[model samples]
Target: MTFTGRPIRIAGASGSASDRRHAIAEFARHYPTDPVDVIIADFMSEFNMATFAGRRMDQAGNAMPAYDLSFLEALEPALGDIAKHGIKVAVNAGVCDTKGLFDVVSRMVQAKGLDLKVAYVTGDEVLPAIQNALSGGQSDFRNIYTGEKLADWDFEPIYAQCYLGGLGIAAALAEGADIVLCGRVSDASPVIGAAYWYHGWQRSDLDKLANAFVAGHLIECSNYVCGGNYTGFKSLEHGGDGWANIGYPIAEISAEGDVVITKQAHSTGGAVTVDTCTSQLLYEIQGPWYYNSDVTAIIDGIHFEQRGVNRVAVRGVRSGPPPPTTKVGITARGGFQAEAWWFLTGLDIEDKARMLEAQIRRLLAPSAEQFTSLKFDLLGSNLPDAKTQNRATVPLRIVAQARDEEALGPRKFVKPISDNIMQGYPGATFHLDMRQGFPRAVFEYYVTLLPQSSVQHQVHLPWKPTARTQVIDISPPPQTKTYPSRQPSQAATHTDQAVDLAKDFGPTIRGPLGWIVHGRSGDKGADANCGLWVRHRDEYLWLRGLLSIDTAHKLLGDDALQQPQLAIERFELPGLQAVHFLFRNLLDRGVGVTTTVDFLGKNVAEYLRSRHVDLPVRFLNRGKL
Candidate 1:
């Protein structure tokens, strides 16, 4: 094989199992003529794996491909097309069942009478290794979030897997495998691995691999790069409805490490623009250093350019050596938690909340004190003469969790309080269909690092008896300094002279910040990051001045709740005309423990952008949106 000047195209078929099965047809229809070299899908997340284990337990199933079949089902329509077009497929669809996934895919290919080579990369699972480590005193299995050792915990892990790098995937592809199935690898590894095979790039090619990593990162969420959850969705059409059947993203990485992001041909819905690319780029990111099992990609230097309509070139990505350890996702049972929401309408919302809480406490008097956690949230404020009925209605949500399943289970916990419904506060109503309100087991996620030497990466084919495993190289962890408490050191360089608050601008217009600025936010483990951007260059200066680190803190911070801006870090991307804010521990111990409706905090940016801010007439009139 010889290197080509043309870049190899990769079409992202789906983001998650939540994707519609018809998306496969969408990709198939376009891919026939366009001819992407490979198709990749990200079917699993941290939450997805635990959810899969629960589902498997519910079904009494003991097999692989148990985590999520939605991805495979989605691609069923395109399986023939994939084989016909000779399009390579790579996926992290395997959670605990790579063999099951591989069997199903191979059977499908055989049924079609297609000669496709199928293989799976394994050795990510370290359950036995974890036990050995614990026994041999090699690792502490300390929780990365809470810093608690797994040994002291009473719960046994339902699913434990360490994240793997792309090398195993690259190895399978290099061995001429048409499809490669992986379990618990990094989300971006599929694309990175495919690029590795096509370019024959070594694992140590940090800069080039970092470029591929960013490209993979950008497209891993599929339609996210195509404006599915973009903040500027409304403004993309400048206030008209243009979003419908949005196309998934397609990435091309040249042999020389050129990253171009685009979409399939003749797609009618969503768009791909610099703003959209920037929004997806910053999603689920912690800071400048984007660490992966393969490399530490420095995102600060990464830049983008809109090459043409729906095509953006990503470049200038720098990198450093990867950390010596791999992160292991240890999911164990955290007991049962259940929640119920009651609507308290009319006057005295706060009083009603208090009365309801008192009533519940009185009713659950015997069991309440025994609960590990009991909390109440009044969703709306008590105001005199509210303008709308929606505003007048406040949801009183009571959530309780317990280590004892029987104590918190349906009969013991839910019955006592649920039986006293009529005796509760007046005008109290409930959500009619609330199956989610029932007590269910909560899986706590404990992430910890395992030395790379502890993991064994290999490629296995059904026909081959000999598994091709990479030899291990040992080394002491590099003496690197990690500055956890250091805040970003950058100040506003330029301020507009004409935009004087009192002089040039006669009066300040009060409106939502979305009137001028656009943003995107997402949760990363327990923390969150929100990126704010502007279309007009003139608005950038004003936005930067208005949305300082202090302003971001003021918008997201709550002094009474004890959730302050103490851990918030702010960064700037002037080229994208965006400001990114990182909030540590923003979620109350993550989505599992958080009582808020937006548990993942995906809408945190919209929440902050909706806050009313004083905008100058100069900026507000620019959009007329």
Candidate 2:
């Protein structure tokens, strides 16, 4: 088929529902004409959804059920503008209740006296399916990390949400939905759904859908593709302006499966370049194959070129069939935790921490069993003849966890620390956050896949059947059929030939990797991936060798490298001159349960960037210092 169709401009307004008000207002200011066919707002993430589910459970009998007002608060002010411009909005801002949010929107818009078609895509809630599986021995539900059964847990489940695709959203838009509210679809699905509807593409049109899928990924995180979170962010125009006026991203997707990612025209402070787009594309991706509920996008075939000022054309796109299963996010109350911190100054920081832990151990001797976990981390250095106060003082952070509130509560956990006030180390003091010392609920997420056949999807056309509520049937796409994994130029096999250092480059200097390389990394549940790229093609060879598995293991430091569960896998994108590394179980029980300092794992790239490495002297002489 010849590629002939209108290009759809999809703009992402909000990264999360909490920032919708600002996102909407900023978009309204920047986009005076409101130049977009569909506005996508991503309001929910794995953390936020779990948080909402926990809140709803807590507010079971409250006078008014708990619903996040941030989304509506943001949308209320922009309703007039949206209705005036006739721009359709797709958002996953509904949290756990799309119906309730839509109901609120229905009333708000009606009061404003605007003619709009408000619809909601529902049926992502999979609690009943989980219950059914649990009732039948729970063998069906397995943890995505460890292949253990969910039935093994003794506690009850808080929430279970399955990831849905863009079909239902397309159906809603087909019926002329002015506002499409959704609970928990893929973050990129809103863009995907909008593109699908705009192009009137078929389910079997893999190439078109693949392009849309990649395009959605580009604009999914508003400012990331527009230089906000990019590693080489300083290269963008006004890169120092900060995020105060950071612009949202816009994707110009053509019918021929070509995408040019850009920012709002005349928007303040950002640039869409090949580097920025590449950075965003590598963010949060597991492998070359970027999988979604609707389709498994083959990102390995990606090709990019700067088409114009502030525009990057991404082409050579392809796709694989959608995965046979959809991932279901399962969350439950893990336990309660209480923590206290003490500062040690002048000297003997580690010594002071050890003494405090010993004192606490003696104090809790009677009820030691009451605590399931007690950890003390001595933060900062106790350098001899310290040059600054910051280096001389260290803080001791002690945390304790238990199965319930009573045992690991503030009264019980804090009493031991407080009792040793006089007997503790000299010049030791504590700055306490009253809430942190108190027992607080901790959530654990169990991510796993479920067959698409079990999902119940419906599109609620609120204006259908006499401007009344109407639910239309929407089915899942056919099972994904496997295809040959795309391997680009950089996939050349490793050569065993000895490196001729003199032939490659004359000499070398040691410096931070960030000087010659850029990187982006993120987490998916317990797993993490980071992509490192070099600007010059000649630098790619050196980087590939520098970041090999053995070198990476050494670079991760002794603690992370020696962990038994740590497994590393590398995929090379030769076309882009980048190496993507997958680190397993790096974030403990994911961000929600991890006790690590880098909880979300957003800083992995920065951590690697900080590592000092050798660079070619000649290359350094040619590039800016």
Candidate 3:
């Protein structure tokens, strides 16, 4: 392998399973005319794993591929452009069935008379290995978040997938695979693999590999780095229309380990400015030390600088050896869940909610104990002296989860609530739709780690001449590091920042925290992270002082305080003028089983930004956003 010297332009076409399907076609369509070397799509997440598990359970041993069909549909239209321009494509849309997807794509390519070679990487599925370990009395599969032993889990695991590094992907690409399909490689693995193959970087090139790792992460979510979920939405023009036309991101990574993040030239909306890039950098990250299967990135020193329109230079990324072990997600059938909603109108909303809860509890008395989880929530408070009917009503939500569908079906869940309407509070009304009351299967997602050596990473591709398939085993990294379980202490930095803010800054005005700061939040399994940053260095000081873990818990209200695993860890990134918080177990059993209204915790940062804060009068005088 040899270095190309020229930078590789890798486009991020898909973020998740639900991302818009037009991106692949659009990127491919613009191809030769406006060249992009490669296109990568990420279609798996913890939530996706749970979704696939439920679907697998419903299939009952049906001989169907577990892969997401959207990827195939998206690629079918782009095949011509891909072939014409010789565009390399890599995606993790294969889910649990890489070979299935590989065969499908190969047939499609052959039918189209296209010369594209199709290959796949496998060995991510490890349920059999996990079962073997458990049978041998191995206890290494403890939950990464709660530290719970797998032996204590209530339900048996149905699926397990270890996150693989980019080496297997790189090997297939190096073997001249035009399209590389994968099963549960790390979300950033495609980009890492692309850069690895493009730059011909050795595994020992830690800094270069780390740079690709960070670049992969920044662009992995497609339009996210292009201001899709931006907190500073007001800055983007055309409002909703602008958002609908948001562009996807691309990383121009050089052999020297430098990267420039940008968007498609013809993108109708969204900008790739420093703030937008910073927002993506801070999202879904646990701390300054960001870990990938291939490299450990020290992001605390990283900085983003806007160079031109829709272009941001990423600099100062440092790296160390990757962790000895990689993460694995274990999924199990959590059982059935159902929910019902009732509206309380006008006066006595709290009393009405309390009465409804009591009535439902009494109605379920015979079998209530069978439920693994049950909760009633008042969604909102009724306004006083309101003119509109909608403003004066609060919603009462009842959610129940049980091991058996019978316990959550119409008789036990919906009928109990439906039978209470006439005996309920004045103007008591349930939602017109009752379908949500029907029980649906739910899966629990548990995250753990396994030694890299345990992964049997392999690449399946055809050799020349005979054109027969060959299985190439990819070894784990030659060198690895075991990071300390404990993180770097924040005591000194917290004390210094707190003291600076305590000193006089004159009078203060209470206002939304968003007035001076921007934030982004996301989930990692059951944990949620909120990253807040300011436009200027001065305001960052105040933000660091004000957003202590206690203050965050208060701003988060009862949800933060109510969770049994309510622990928050804070970290600071002075280079980016950002302060981030990681709320453990806040999403509750991950996205699959979480009953939180926010679901993936995407709204946590916005909620924190909406909270009123004692803003320095001096800062407020400058501008009021």
Candidate 4:
């Protein structure tokens, strides 16, 4: 079967099973009535093994695919429909050794004698390779697991693949594979791959592929790019349709691989503009190098031109050198940790933070034996020297780590915070919420070279085993859990948490306080009292805020509350009275709003005045405006 349309678009499903199924169904409903060409499902994460194994075993008995096989299994039910329309399905599931995966695919294709071609893309694990490059053979880097040098083994990897680019997928498609499987490829690989295959671009066609990859990246996270995380974006004026059912992003790729990232034409949300597209481009793309199944593109020149409201044309990107080595995963025993948090509310946010810090330090003084390490973070209004003229809530998070299991157990280190809630600070209230502790495993990694000839690609057909048949499972590596080293103490009780002042204000307001308000608007509309602020220029800017239990409950409730407006109002302090009024209103707003306050101030007076109506307001003049 061959693709006959403009290009095959593969949409990513949410990590959740239900969400993925819904996404697939939605894709099917919107696309051609008949199967277009290929439908690929990607289910990647450490926790998916159990889910995949359980589902497959229930369906096909004990003969189960590898742990990474969930990607394929998810689309198995759709196979008949896809095949009926002469389309194929591809999936990236399970963890297998990289070399092993390539070998398995190569062997399968040759044995089956099917008219299929295969290729392997690499470069996901670059940390080890970077380490190897930085260290010149003298001092080998120790695995986080074994604590031993990594050069003791004879393992070689073909593809030092990072989150890959579209080139490899294009290579596979060009080679004429009915199906393609990849490891550690970028979320946009399939989409970019389809574009390259359709355009028949070469590996050196960096400009075209990079443009296509950017478009793919914009829509890769499914919801985030399509206004899910867009700041200042309000609901549609007509109905709740915009927020209720957000449309997924789509890309229109030309024959030259120039891409336009947009949403369905009839969708309720607005189009993708330069601002929206730039925001998506910067999302989660750590540093300069962006990797895919093949090729590393240097995001040096990201130029965006608005074609339409929801359509953006991205161009001018460069390519980089592939890493010389591959990353190896190694797991070993670590230690354990436990943590607890409390809420502090009322007008004395700065004093509350100081008292809590002293109290926690005193608590640790008596029996520091129980914990190897201790940390404290003043969340919300409890932050040091926060300014507000209202009742603010501060949250205190305390974390403790121990070498032995017994010392780190929940009852030993975690229970003390809960036990001393009423004893520590007068207004301190401790909730029953305690973070559970678990064993930590450290994985040490190394980078080594493998001749390109060692890596092979093949396709496997499902059939009954022959007398000489030997079945080998091909899946990605298992994910390991790491333990936290230092956990902080709770800064405040639930009642004293801070609110975000910037987000609560109107767009017309401008000041340091307005800056604070704007900052909180992006931080999930947390209470102003439950946040921290820093004074710069003539304005008091809200830096960060912590979530309060009550506020969390309300925001996450079934009924939709106007959180965005609240954020706007809190941050938009019109004047001294507005600041005072906002703070006083926080107290009247009850535990829900007051429980999320946190602050950071230059001194105690500034902090107190920001939260007290009766206090004298002394505005700081820092030259210029």
Return the TM-score for each candidate structure.
Answer: 0.89, 0.91, 0.95, 0.56
Please provide, for model 1 over 314-386, each residue's C-alpha lDDT reduced to its tens digit, 9 standing for 90 to 100.
9778887777777787767677788877888888777888988888888777877668888888764655687
Cα error, residue 355 of model 3, in Å, equals: 2.3
Off by over 4 Å in 3: 1-5, 57-64, 137-139, 238-241, 382-387, 463-469, 489-498
| Model 4 Cα lDDT, one tens digit per residue, 79-143 | 33343443433344323233344566556556655444444444443444534543665346443
Candidate 3 on 1-625: residue-level lDDT in tens? 6557579999999999889998888998997556788899999988778778666555666744588889998999999999888899999998877787888888998999988988889999888878777778764588888988888877788888999988888888888988999989998889999999988889999899888999999999998899889987777776433765888888999998889998987755887889998998988988877787788898889898889888899988999998988888988988888999999899888888889888888997776888988989888688899999999988888899998998887888888889988788889799989998999888888888877887889998864445354778988888889987645535224554564555656677888998888999999888899999988777877778777777888899877768877888888888898888888888877888888777888999988888898889888777755
lDDT on C-alpha atoms for all candidate structures: 0.75, 0.77, 0.85, 0.43
Q: CA RMSD for every model?
A: 3.8, 3.5, 2.1, 14.6
Looking at model 1, the pairs that clash are 64-97
Q: Name the better of 1 and 4 by TM-score.
A: 1
* lDDT tens readout by residue for model 2, 407-450: 87555778777777888889868875656788777778888777
Query: Which residue segments of model 1 deviate by more than 4 Å?
Result: 1-3, 53-65, 134-142, 146-158, 236-241, 380-392, 465-507, 564-566
Predictions ranked by lDDT, top down? Answer: 3, 2, 1, 4
Q: Distance (Å) between predicted and true CA of 568, model 2?
A: 1.6
- For candidate 4, the lDDT comes to 0.43
Q: How close to the true structure is residue 271 of candidate 2, measured as C-alpha lDDT?
A: 78
- Model 3 residue-pair collision total: 0
